[model samples]
Target chain A: MYIHAVSHYFPSEVVGNEHFTRLNGLSSEWITERTGIRERRKAAPDENTNTMALEAVRRLFDQTAIDPSQIDLIVGATYTPYDTIVTLAHVVQHNLGVPDIPVISVSTACSSLINAVEVVEGYFAMNKATLAVVVVSEHNTAYNNETDTVSGHLWGDGAAALLISKERISDEDMTIHTIITGGAATSGKATTGVMLKPLEQGVLMPHGRDVFINACLYMPKVSLQVLEKHNLTIDDVDYLIPHQANLRISLNVINTLKLPETKLLSNIQKLGNTGCAGCAIALSENRALFKKGQNIVLTVFGGGYSFGAMLVEV
Target chain B: MYIHAVSHYFPSEVVGNEHFTRLNGLSSEWITERTGIRERRKAAPDENTNTMALEAVRRLFDQTAIDPSQIDLIVGATYTPYDTIVTLAHVVQHNLGVPDIPVISVSTACSSLINAVEVVEGYFAMNKATLAVVVVSEHNTAYNNETDTVSGHLWGDGAAALLISKERISDEDMTIHTIITGGAATSGKATTGVMLKPLEQGVLMPHGRDVFINACLYMPKVSLQVLEKHNLTIDDVDYLIPHQANLRISLNVINTLKLPETKLLSNIQKLGNTGCAGCAIALSENRALFKKGQNIVLTVFGGGYSFGAMLVEV
Candidate 1:
């Protein structure tokens, strides 16, 4: 499948450690050192999960020139939906004037975007859809504890939309070469311990170290699998877009893989971890850096102990 | 596609109008008159969405002698998932010991079972999976407000599973003939007014009159489209399994279509509306009513203002 276009949206408001210090006793340097994030975008009072997704999808439609009616499927990957009854896909379909097509909502935490991509591949493979749109949006700030220095500074609100088509682009345009994807849980005992907010008393607690350990170990292994599948080493790849869970984890995976600095793409320093939208947002923002036939690897480790990787030739 | 077997699970505990009378000031006669439901089942405190789905899936595996790992795809249709982090399909896969295969969780309200069928059809069309399982489960009791007489007594908790395979048993071994699917919203001023729990006052308040009018008008029309495409008439159908949204709506549709009384299959009087599980559960329970080479029609309408119809030969 070829990615015809990609777009992302981050709200206008920015929250930094100074704002956190006013709410909690944390310094900017301390927060930055712990999570590799200095600031993050926050949704305005009126902005929401649906609004962010619509912004990204609207831009994608404008850029791709694909009519919404031509899109056969709409997949929304998010943990925070505006309404459980209606589904976020319905909101997007209604807003975009494509209400008759089949819509599905997927939630696999941070790896959700790839999961949605896999589903789109299934539709394409089945000849059920010629064109598909995947919208991944998350409001991780809703799950943050303003007083918790670890999570507060490590989260952000944003959305990304990618338009995929079974019609392969010419080699001169762009292409996806191969994908190697799999995930496993750690005995169902190594819990990430992360919880969504509006929790009672001690509900929302996470073992950040355990999560870091899992990401540092599993992601690079998956990335290597994709590289091996394509018979290409990391040295041949031009860019590696890892899920923006944290800046430290990305660097750790890069160093462990022995990849060069110029090969890594990241936006967590400014955008923080946007949950499912992290990798897609990074790719959309850095599209200019990509060249025809350039090899790029995208990997993600998310909640539910899920992780996946894909190799694309751009 | 051939259906090897079908199984369903309804919680053992049944709640009658006597139970509702104590919680709300509703008379048994009034409840039975308003909706065709006389009683409904609620899952035990320990039973959840995953457990209910597992129960139905186990029955399918046991009856078909199919290994969990051999099943290529698992599609779970539900509105009440345990958490937003992991899809209920993953929980089902883990519980069933089929963790490697891809799983998709789809939410199309009460039409989810039919939607899952369409997805499996696509897979078979693409030759991706020789065998697939589609599970529809609902724990509607969790969202019911005892005070809301309109919806509280109309919903039940249950699940159903179908084993669809690419191998053909015979030319008429439960093959999909045609599926006409679409959705339409009422004018901008009109809304379904169906509110999900824990977010919007924890009640299911639907505009009963509008929903009834819409179902009576649209359900038969879609059914006709499916029959017309198959070059058959209503007189040729062996049975009709409409989504168990209400007894009155079903009867109204039957009267308008002028179908024979012996040809309609209904379990709503015994099990109430089980949301996405309604059509599947009804089919599973009433399979004895169908004969080889007989035509059957399944239609559904639900909260997303969505409706679909499919014709099949059993």
Candidate 2:
């Protein structure tokens, strides 16, 4: 499997930390220091998971100018969906007016995009599809509880998409390394405090300590395992694209792995935690900065005790 | 991929048609005649999508006496999940104490299981997973609206599990035909009346007429397309396993395809529509009757305006 292009879309609303700080009786400096999030984008009143995702995919198509008829599959990853009945992928395909294709939605919280990448890789391997698109659209606002400071300020709305194909289309296209592996540890779910429960208001309460600790432990472990399998070390990785859940968690993983701070790539400060789209969006924004041949390690941990890591070359 | 074993489990509560006949103005004979549903299972007070699915997989393991360790991936298909955060796959893996594996939840309405099978097949084709488990556990009782008679009486709660391996383990193992293909048409969502709107009651009000007309058309078309790809026709099919939404819809599809009535295997008379688990549960209950080298076609349509078809061999 190879990545032909990557793109992202965010709503127009740029919400600053002052809103939460004033409402929760905390200073802007405190919020910034705690989460390293100065501002994040919020979906507009009319914007939604489906529309944002559609725009991101349209942007990918615009940049690549790939024929829409050539795309044979659409894999959508989302934890916060606009509607439970009409899938995000179907809405996207219908809106795009693309040909009838296999549109599947896979949910494993924030690790969704990587899992979807592997899924499309399988399709390519089996010759089921030659060209595929993977998109992650999340409306975290639907699950945010305004009064609950822990989770309220942590979520942001956005969408990201990537075009993958079995054949390398151009010299600029990046190939995914053969050392991709992902799995989850269920014991992490037993730590009850960190959970996204469906309340009357659709609020997701998170235990900040438990989530931070578990993410620090698993993200590094999985990243190292994927690297070790390829007979490589953290020093061999040019860039570390960890899930932008929190700057502290990302920093912690870097310190644990003893990687240089410059290698840590993130956009959470401006984007917040976009759930499944976090790391993929970061990659899309940072794609131009990478050389033609550089090793980038993508690691992620999400709600529901899901964690995974994959190494790709750009 | 080859199916090593298949097993299903239903809740203890057997809800007879009389429960709906007395509430509404219809008689038991009218209910059976219209939908061919005499009774359906309802989950107990303590049972959930995860518990029901866990039991189904446990039965598969016990009956086959296969080491649980051999299973490397778990893909759970469901439209009604207990929580959006904790995937049904993660919960099942937690309860079963299965090793750390990729636990993914996919939703394509009632067509979920067949789509999941194709996803796992891709994994096998790429050698990403050796032995994978696909479970369709539906708790339709969670979304049923007693007042909306059209959709309420048409749902039942049950779960089914299948162990699919890249290699055939025994002489009795069933191999999936090499011609498996699946895709969805999105134009159906444009129909106005047939939609599942999110309401305060958490109910999905489906338009009966539109669903009937479309399922009758697309189900047969996709089924024939898949068979034609393999140089086979409906007459060559040994069994036609249509989604157990309603007996009327199934019969309409059979009439359109001109498939023999005897070749149409169904359990909707006893197990209403089980959502994503419908076809899989029917297959599990009827697996013993299947002869070697039998050709089976599974066709399904779900509320999200999604539909697909798969051809398999036994």
Say which candidate scores most in DockQ: 2
lDDT score for residue B307 of model 1:
70
- State residue B164's C-alpha deviation in candidate 2, in Å: 0.9
Clashing pairs in 1: none
Q: What is the DockQ of each candidate?
A: 0.34, 0.50
Of the candidates shown, which would achieve the greatest lDDT relative to the real structure? 2
Per residue, candidate 2 scores C-alpha lDDT tens digits across B62-168 of 87867877788889888777666676777766766665577788977778888888888888887778888899998878767765676678789999999998898
Q: What's the C-alpha lDDT at position A197 in model 2? A: 36
Q: By TM-score, who's the top model here?
A: 2
lDDT of each: 0.75, 0.80
For residues A1-314, write the lDDT of model 1, one tens digit per residue.
88888889999899887887788778888888877788889998677777888899999888765677787777778766555556566567667676556666666667778777876776777666777788989877755667775565677899999888888743433555565433343324223345441212211436777777777877898898888978999888889999998888999999999998778899988888899899999989988889987888899977655677888888
Alpha-carbon deviation at B84 in model 2, angstroms: 2.0
Q: Give the range where candidate 2 chain A is weakest over 10 consecutive residues by summed lDDT.
A: A190-199
TM-score of chain A of 2: 0.95
- Candidate 2, residues A68-178: lDDT per residue as tens digits? 778888888887766555767767667666655777888887788888888888888878788988999988876677667767887788999999988989888888775
